[model samples]
Target: MSEADARLQDMELPTALYESTDDGYLATALTIGPWDAGLQHAGPPAALLLREAERAGAIEGGQTVRMAYDIFAPVPVGPVRITASVVRPGRRIELVETVLTAGDERPLMRLSAWRMRARSDGAAPEPPAPHPAASGPEESRRELAAFFTTEVAYHRALDWRFPTGSFNSPGPASAWTTPRCTLVAGEPMTPLQHLLVMTDAASGISAVLDWTTATFANVDLLVSLHRPPRGDWLGMDAVTTLGGTGAAQCTAVLFDAEGPIGRSAQSLFVEPR
Candidate 1:
């Protein structure tokens, strides 16, 4: 990995084990960086909750799972409780919900993850035309450094290249990306996790009246995963729209070699810079 990538990889939660008390509750404390939003930190905490369910034998092999997180409040930089409960346990599918609460038991975020079994057969669709190659990382990184605040901690888990040139000048900028960090211990970093990371990077270029378009924080994020990520190289083609009222939105359709894997949308708060 490059130096920047190595730096990013080292920032993730290094451990999964959570300390439990006699009451069987797992709680831990964390510090959030200035640029770190709640959603970005939500994934690791949610994963920890899932692992807890696994250790308790609530979920097993040969099953499929789906997970979602609802951000209730900004994640605090301190101790919080992560709790998991099984909603439905089926022979082939399992439904699980996890919650992270701050001190005094106020909800910070809630996640509902699904687990299920795989089918033996499936149909095939024609593949899409290939995207043009992206630009080198060194160039893209320099452009990114100009707008994004250097203070926020960014996990360099992925290598990103932009084929279309700098987003700072305007128009379409496409990025090809791959993970530099090793994913969670047993889980192979599914498409869900890929979407979780790449979805937030879509709005990096536009300039809004309230906030700088570069490195905008997402107020809400939603991703629809259509297929498993087939290759290490994934592509993101993003566009931004600014409203007269001073807010903005960015949408990016993400793809892998097999085809269009999924798309992501973000609602952002902006003010004139």
Candidate 2:
């Protein structure tokens, strides 16, 4: 396999492909698409795509871009293409966009990198409370070799648990998540990585035994990482707020055995299975 092919076939995106030119690499995550379960469609794979772009120097740090994604029909489980381009570059921020396509359909996602700007003394946003340590389920040591994604690999390393839900349930579920390992790939997890793990677990929310026959997919996901997860064992206590009219949303409070780390919410499209 060529370097481009090697990058695409790298197991990071479940089953993705990569194309290259004089400019940069274009990757496509085939098996995992918009129609796949949220567990697959939303997570490290998407983040990895953006991170790959950053690593490729197509985008710099610090800038905000609205990432609007559309699910034109259901994304298939074959080959998909991810092509990225630099939109704007500035001293403090940069804008970039990447389009993921399978066959003839196109679903695009955008990213904005905003580097920290030097500022004088002024009022700053208050920091979030520390995440509480794993007391009940999060602390339990468990082996996870079944899950294929690297995100799940880290989950097992953290020794957390999902007290209730499974992947395709109806209501909210609790995930005893923690970082099993640190991000040796340069800086700690980018906000994109955090968002990937944060949004992927919604299916487990309905893990309660009674809510087993329902499923939902994210319509939109908004993530604001006040500070990246520095340690392992980030726990997620999640629940659904409004899931109707072919759409749903859920909220989760992330923790890491200190107090409260951060909060995340995702809008989902739902259906009965």
Backbone clashes under 3 angstroms, per model:
21, 28
Regions of model 2 farther than 4 Å from truth: 1-40, 56-74, 108-128, 132-138, 141-160, 163-171, 178-195, 206-213, 255-261
Clash tally for model 1: 21
TM-score of model number 2: 0.59
lDDT of 1: 0.53
List TM-scores for all candidates, in order.
0.64, 0.59
Expressed as tens digits, the lDDT of each residue in 176-268 for candidate 1 is 666544334334655445555555556663333223433345565555554555666676778778775657787777777555766666776
Residue by residue across 128-233, what tens digits does model 2's lDDT show?
Answer: 5644433445344433323234322223223336655434444666666544332223246544454454455544443332233445666554444444444444
